[model samples]
Target: MDHPHLPGPAARHAPPEHPEGTAHAATLASFDRGLRREARPDGPGCRVERTGRVVRQTGPRHAWNGILWSGLDATNADAVIADQIRHYDALGLDFEWKAYGHDGPADLPARLLAAGFTAEDEETLMVAEAATLPRRIDLPAGVRLVPVTDAAGVRLVTEVHERAFGTDSAHIGRQLFDRLASAPDDVAAVLAMAGDEPVSAARLELYPGTDFAGLWGGGTVASWRGRGLYRALVAYRAGIAASRGHRYVQVDAADTSRPILLRLGFTPLTTTTPYVHAPATVR
Candidate 1:
């Protein structure tokens, strides 16, 4: 497959420069290489593999299974997609093929839909310079952000996620607990509290070989919306990322958080949608 658009190894290793778009592309390339090179079958039972130009990722059975860092041309797209579906089907694992706007072949999305993959919500790949992100955000007088350090803190984060998203967050809580035990410095979770009650929470995952650190699960309880709590959580995580030598912070922004992320200096580089393939048993 032609990888004309994919960055070469040298480009992936070079230091990123500023202006959000430049940083965004550099960080995306760096992260793609990092995922293929450094991601291991660690805590989340997640493992990555390289097949031809496609990078496949499989995680815990209950969690998401997916593909990443794909660079395919018209000649090979069909075979690559078919192989992925067959491999996952044999393993009885439902998987997602993550398609980014800048990905090659231009018609990969249409092909995926024809092959029985269901498109999920489209999200913006938002990126910002870590140093440019707001460092100090004022929370409501009584509310404060706290770093998660124990099971109680994990539970607090889970509670805020559940309440904010209206769904069970046990899976995320479990992953957070395991990550803390194995690579505490690589990941950090924070919770916003109004005295004893948790109001908002988020997690940051720092990639050692890349310039980007990812922000995930920044959800605030509905009652706490519009109070700057979400932005404060973002500021706190960006500070952490900067302290750890990460040059940029990236988030997969949905409707609720996209505007807030934009206001905080994040620029949308591309849209990504997950094309899911589930076996009949799963469907």
Candidate 2:
């Protein structure tokens, strides 16, 4: 779980210490400790590894593989980065290093670029108390929410995803299908169905033993936008998180979704950018 906005697990690792009173810094710190530093595998066949000052997750090629958390500065940053490159390169896996704006040395992103990693879009790490978010899920006319269970339901979810995002969803389809089959309790996948057609979709990932739940892959087909479908999806998942004793629900939100989430009482915590290195691109 590197990039929060992606359809994947939220990054885990204790966040670096921040100065007090820096606009929700304490909550950000808690998020870092619970999600980043203490990251766990999203599903079966995935493993998290802690090597020295870094924590990384490895899985099958279809699954996410990345460095979730790291402790690096000027002295060890370059060496550690090289080590990770070699490690993943040997395995022939393309991986991501999720760097936060608050991460140390203030030049981690630059170092990553120097190491041949390409930077992706930045996203705001947002969190809200599950109790404080809206709980009533009011869908658009002719739309009803359905819980996704079997492969057929997953197909519907992916259909909406592909229409909304305009990208191939096979990778996400595999991840969601496997997660539903193996650890259904850890996740809640929902689709807004209009008759036999899906108009919107989203999922909630519950982190056991932690107070946070992650909301991922919320999207509505173009025809369904601006009709409260997105808001209903958020409320539905936040309510589920609250029922499960999770105090907070977090989202790695993009510019398009940030204002909507902010209107729903979410607080901006920090920003994260993913640096991806393809094994074939460089050694």
> Which tens-of-lDDT digit does each residue in 36-100 have in candidate 2?
89988997799999997899998888888999888898999999999999988888899999888
RMSD of each: 7.0, 4.7
Weakest 10 consecutive residues of candidate 1 by summed lDDT: 1-10
> Poorest 10 consecutive residues of model 2 by lDDT?
1-10
Q: Candidate 1, clashing residue pairs?
A: none
Q: Which stretches of candidate 2 lie over 4 Å from their true place?
A: 1-23, 281-283
Clashes of each: 0, 10
| lDDT per residue as tens, model 1, 200-265 | 999998877777888988888889888998888889999999999998888888766877888889
| TM value for model 1 | 0.86
lDDT to native, each model: 0.79, 0.85
TM-score of each: 0.86, 0.91
- Cα displacement (angstroms), candidate 2, residue 44, comes to 1.4
